[model samples]
Target: MNAPNGHSWHPETGRLFRLVIDQLQCTMCTLTIHDTHHAEYDIVDMFNMPDYLANRLAIDIDKSIQIDAWIPEKSNQAVSFDYEGDDGQDRFCGLTYYCRADPTVLLALSVCWQDGSAPDEWRDRREAIDAWVDAHLRLLWRSHRDRGRVGSLEHTLNLFDFTVIVLAADGNILFANEQAHALLDVGDGLRRAGHSITATDFDDAVRLQTAIQHLSHSDEQTKSTDAGVATVLLLRRANARPLVASLARMPPTARGSAATVLHVIDPDGETRPLVGELCRAFGLTPTEATLAHHLVEGLTIDGAAQAMRIQRQTARAYLKQVFVKTDTHRQADLVRVILNGIVPIKASLSLPANGGNGSARSGAK
Candidate 1:
């Protein structure tokens, strides 16, 4: 089973936590606080709650439950509270367990009843529930920690507008970000072949494989020299400009079995920086920022004007203002400044919709 939010849900592990909730005849919610001081946390999982209530709790968690008042001095400290919903009609009795093993991981086990009054049996079984959590705390912590780590990495990779892929020493695909998967699924230039990524053209495939092998088998000195420098290759496509691929070896600490990290940028694809980001970074108006974005995306002044549906002279005026604000006189300088600036580092919220292509899979492929 999957979580309502599409997170991986392990029924067996969930059942372990659900056992106590069943015994107590109440709904259960599990939360993990990555940073308690700054109130950075997320609901790891929940069980036995109606979809409406769960959604409401996820959105208005801070307003509904106050956990800042009581910081558990030690691990396995269970704190209980009674709180009403925003409308004041729906009431809940919950117990939050804080396990400060890492000073960041707080396990909140909310046992809720809707009627404002919890049964006497719940009070009597409180110690038993705490004992059960203590007995299985390590297992529970590992499950949540691993899930959060994977989810965070996937999200971070998806934020990039370009394609990112991780390859093993032998060129097996270990992981691919959302953009990479989409690009591969399109089968324009690069596509997944068995467990490895392959280019459509013979020469491109040879060059790509050679680059991956070089990075994979590089000595310590060569690796150090190549650090921060990528081996650039161009993958030939059927219609568009060749996709530019930058290959670099992963750091020793992070490599594990993965040898190379490949970042592919499709020149003809929509790789425009956000207009709002450009405006804030360069202190330009929305129109000026939009014009600057087009320039950075490889559109000439006339081309940009045509795309923006404005007069050529008006576009030139916007470009002049952009140059003054961005401290760049030439178009090349403008593109370089914007590309190397903080604009590209900003994560794009909008993602391409997944297609029906059958070849977009991650993990050992």
Candidate 2:
């Protein structure tokens, strides 16, 4: 592998340094050597290197010899180096070990002293330090990789219009998407209490808790029979439509401790079916598609006509065309077809500004 740039330090490096410091009382630096003519490299120092010694080392070292000598043909070899300052008052000692997992990477353990005297015990403890590095190197790399994957997944989930929350087996909140956070912030039907999510209503809370637990802790035989199925619960709201929440178990092969995912859909939330999608799928004109969009958003025919500023008769004419093109004769079936189809899964142009009740002008083309 090529060398990481100066700014590219893995977060797990700090934890590894903490462990190393406790054992050796030395500064730990992980260097990635570039396969270049100048032997360019990057180093992660845990802020343990003193400013004076760091400046002197940068100004007074031969780049090739200082960096390239660390690369070993065998994994177990340890290379040592010592430098004396101009007055012979400052001394520096470092041991570089080859990384078994990545050939281009090197681990340098060093210490500096103001007086000529420095600890020689590092030489005796060389074997112990090398063994510790070999044992923890792979684990730290895995942790860094997993953290990156989780960050990417969180960003992807934030793009959706509905709420998504991931929970552990004990119903603790492991992750919550942007929409879920907003939903909990409002404290209407559902809210986050302490570390877990709960419904405001007594009965709804019981059902929600039970569903999460069952899906999270189901036995192997039960999981096989309902592997892909999601358990649905309706959470009631005093002022508006009830929220629909679907709970499902994360697959056994998933990496993290997240055992259940709750997907909550608010009925009054912004409807995001694209006008182009409706037109292409149902072969309706833009005007007809607009009317269909309003219906799917839970508007009655009169309400849709009023919202569109069209005459009642004109709206009825558009609805008739939409029904014939979509092969659905009733309003309920039209909504069912659109919701159950692939249109709702398409990315929305924008999120609602008012959290749940905001309206966006449909982009009809």
Candidate 3:
């Protein structure tokens, strides 16, 4: 690797700094470094030229090393790596650093150049700068590979209102953010046995499992370029109201092909309003509609009455009417009828006329 402007390598600021000050004039320079893990990078530190340049040079021991610009594509083309000036086309030269670690990190530095300066002056040092940057990346990657620590993820979760939970592929709870603890009925005492979360019944557990599976499959097929998908599932508790979980794929790219993030968003508002709307459209009275809606929501008659704030006798009477009007003889039958009746107007139009029956006549040719 060649050193910038024939100066020795300086760990304080890297080789790009000296080259910019010696070979170029009247320009501002910026240097930044970061780590890359989980297919992403986070910035670590930065420095501004001139002020930091003196500090960098003072610490250097070697005279100067010259390096060749490494072109990842289109080789032998001497292109000046612009540190800081305007290139007349409004494009400026910049350097980006990324570390390959468990969570990944990124750094970006911009060097603004003096206007109307010839490109050849900076081109001379391009090889040297590229070599230094490549070397820095190697060092950063090795450091992360050896060190295992959760740096920003712990404190960062507090900044968001949503609760973050990490779940293993086998439905075991790994960790939970602070918000996760407060929002759900989970804490150190209740979280024993590795089952931090509790659902109302088997159905709720199945729903969560299905959601996780769907999210995992979606994340895999979508590739890294597109925005990841969030899986939505209703997690209901016996004592507490249900929560809407927005499960997503988290960083470090799920080592075992699983969703890393399980965001449990509390469910807000009533769940039966849409069912009530359909009941009203089907000419059901408010009481009958309430019964029908709750039934569709998997509530028993007793449950529906409590929800409707009505006596069991009154609720039963309304449910009987709902069954009769909807031509259903049982609660399950009534639910099926009500759901089938609520087809959107556009969808109803798509149905074949005359109950899908076709008229046929005998004919002789």
Candidate 4:
């Protein structure tokens, strides 16, 4: 399905790893895949970024980067290319390549070695490593692209009046919506450091980072217990209002990486977007969706009906269908289900008026 922002939530493309690369950079990281993020740990401190990447917009296969002592040469035979470490001061095992999603600059990684030389045995394993990196590179780029489409300012997360940050296990800030960027932009509260998220308050930073680190290292036994019960943290910015964040380990929708999702909410922010998601999730028609939204706002059925410009009987009819479809007889249970349910990316919430097969099909009523 799709969200109102037109980003699709589907089995093939999950929301979990959307900002994985960004998250990996927030902490000291080691990767078996394209290590483009390591560019932040670049030599020159002025821009504090690898000039090749810090200035570029995308990395296409046709173009290449000039690392100090090395040059990029695409290998039609292999999925990787080589780079000299620190302008040839040291030798490293690794290559750089870009993905279809972002082609202006290449991604990088280095298999370390002392004395700047690959061991004799390492030569035998080079082809295998290349194959692995090649296999995973494009997929990672796709994840970033998909995430940008859904979680970016043009999408649903930003339209709502809440701050959303997605992090990797290592506490790297992978993706932050528009609301989050504003908070980070002002120096005093929160901000982006080279490949990391930083805060003016040491305790808040430590607390959040620790939670994210914990989520990153969580085992199966602990993950189940931590799923719905999120860790809450208060980020007291320098001159801004304190931000209350609900931090949780978002279990992966598919296999591979999962991330820590931080939802920074305003004490009085409206939940209309969430309600819109709820309506689309259970096939609620426009009127029914409006009714459900009103209920979520703490209105009674009569009040909701009156507010939606419908008769109490019609509202009751819609409510009964909602109960049957949602498998809840009580209003509280219905509300809980909607609030707690996964916010799926779904198609449009459009449904016919007067509630037809919509109770069985879509939510807009």
Task: Tell me which of candidates 1 and 2 scores higher on TM-score.
Answer: 2
* Candidate number with the higher lDDT (1 or 3): 1
Clashing pairs in 2: none
TM-score of each: 0.58, 0.67, 0.32, 0.38
Best by TM-score: 2
* Candidate 2, residue 82: lDDT: 72
- For model 2, the run of ten residues with the poorest summed lDDT: 356-365
Query: CA lDDT of 101 in candidate 2?
Result: 53
Q: Model 1, clash count?
A: 0
What are the per-model C-alpha RMSD values against the true structure?
11.4, 7.1, 16.2, 15.8
Clashes of each: 0, 0, 27, 28
How does model 4 fare in lDDT?
A: 0.55
Best by lDDT: 1
lDDT of 2 by residue, 1-365 (tens): 23323443566566666766555556534433233235444443434555455544432332534554534556556665676756666666665554545444343333343343435675666677777775666555566558889999888888777899988878889889888999999988999889999999999999998888788777777766655578988899989999999888886545433378888998876554444464455566667778888887779999999999999999999898777777779999988877776333325543232222211213222
Candidate 4 residue lDDT tens string, 114-153: 3434345544455544544544555555765676776555
* TM-score quality measure for candidate 2: 0.67
Return the candidate ranking by TM-score, descending: 2, 1, 4, 3
lDDT of 1 by residue, 1-365 (tens): 11255352454447756676676666656544434444444555666565555544443434333464455665667767676776768787676665554554455555567775566777677767676676565566777668889999988878777889988878898889889889999998899899999999999999988988888877777766765568999999999999999998875446444378999987775445443464454566667778888887778999999999999999999888777777779999988877776333334463222211121112111
